[model samples]
Target: MKRLFYSSAIYTALGLLSGLFYREMSRANNFDGYSQLNVTHTHMLVLGTIMFLVFMLVEKNFSLTRHQKLFNWFFVTYHIGLLLTVAMQMTNGIMTIKGIEVSPAIAGMSGLGHIFLTVAFILFYILLNKSAFKNKK
Candidate 1:
């Protein structure tokens, strides 16, 4: 529970910061159009903040400590994915705004982040299923 709360708090901070960044960057750029930075802000809020809050609530109900290792892995992997995706998105957005072309490798990094997130979600589902049925007679 502590771990969940801590993670959720960190993600909430990150999401808020990202939103501020997006707003400032857009204003600086004269609000010309959408950018990958916008995506970064939204993803951080939805996936990082909201999702982790939901996870924390679920933890309260399900007592995920029984699968400590799995929970730890899920937490680590999800954060890694979220960081990677947001970083790449910021890079891509900055480059786009500056009229620069993005390299294929950078684009590939974003895809890799998605893969990590997918794996984390799978682990989370397994954990949820196990915990949900653990005491069912």
Candidate 2:
């Protein structure tokens, strides 16, 4: 539970920082378009902050620590995915704004991040199902 709370708090701070970065970048004319940074901000808020906070609630109800390994994997993979995706978006957005071509590798990494996130969610679902069914008895 403490881990969940800490993770959620960290993500909340990151989300706020991402929003600020987006606004500052736009105001400075650093980007011709704000789409990628906008996506970063939104993703941070939704996936990083809100999702983790929701997971904290789930932890409270389900005692997710009982499945410690699965919970750790889910937490780690989700954050890694979030970080990878956001970092790629930031890099690509900044490069585009500076009249540089975005790298194919960066796009590939972003896709990989989504894959990690997908796997994490699948693990989370399994954890939830296990907890729920166990409690049904």
Candidate 3:
């Protein structure tokens, strides 16, 4: 629980910082056109902060930690994915603003990050299911 809360708080800070970065960077560059920065803000808030808050609620009711292995794996994989995704996104956004050519590998790694998040969610749902049923039977 504390872990979840801390994670959410960290993400909240990160989300706000990312938003600021996007705004300041764009303003500096006089850039108002499309860029990956646009989505970085939303992704951090929605996926990083809010998603963990939702999971915290689930943990309170479901005792997700009862499945210790799943909980640990979910925690690690979720962070790895979110960090990778956001880092690559911000990198691409910065590259765009600086008129630097973007690399294909960055996008590919971002896709892999999404895959990690997907797997983490699957583990979370499984933990939720086990916690729900373990209490029943």
Of the candidates shown, which would achieve the greatest lDDT relative to the real structure? 3
- Residues 1-137, candidate 1: write the lDDT tens digits: 87777877887788788888878877887767878987887788788878888998898899776899988888888888988988999999888777789898888999999899999999999899889899786
Question: lDDT tens string, model 2, 27-50?
Answer: 787555646777787888888878
Residue 35 in candidate 2, Cα distance off native in Å: 3.5
What tens-digit string does per-residue lDDT give for candidate 3 at 1-137?
A: 99999999999999999999999999999998888998998999999899999999998988999888889999999999999999999999999998999999989999999999999989888888899888476
Query: Please, what is the TM-score per model?
Result: 0.90, 0.91, 0.96
Candidate No. with top TM-score? 3
What lDDT would candidate 1 get against the real structure?
Answer: 0.85
Comparing 1 and 2 on TM-score, the stronger one = 2
Clashes of 1: 0
Candidate 1 wrong stretches, greater than 4 Å: none
Any residue pairs clashing in model 1, and if so which?
none
Misplaced by over 4 Å in model 2 are: 30-32, 135-137
* lDDT-sorted candidate list, best first: 3, 1, 2
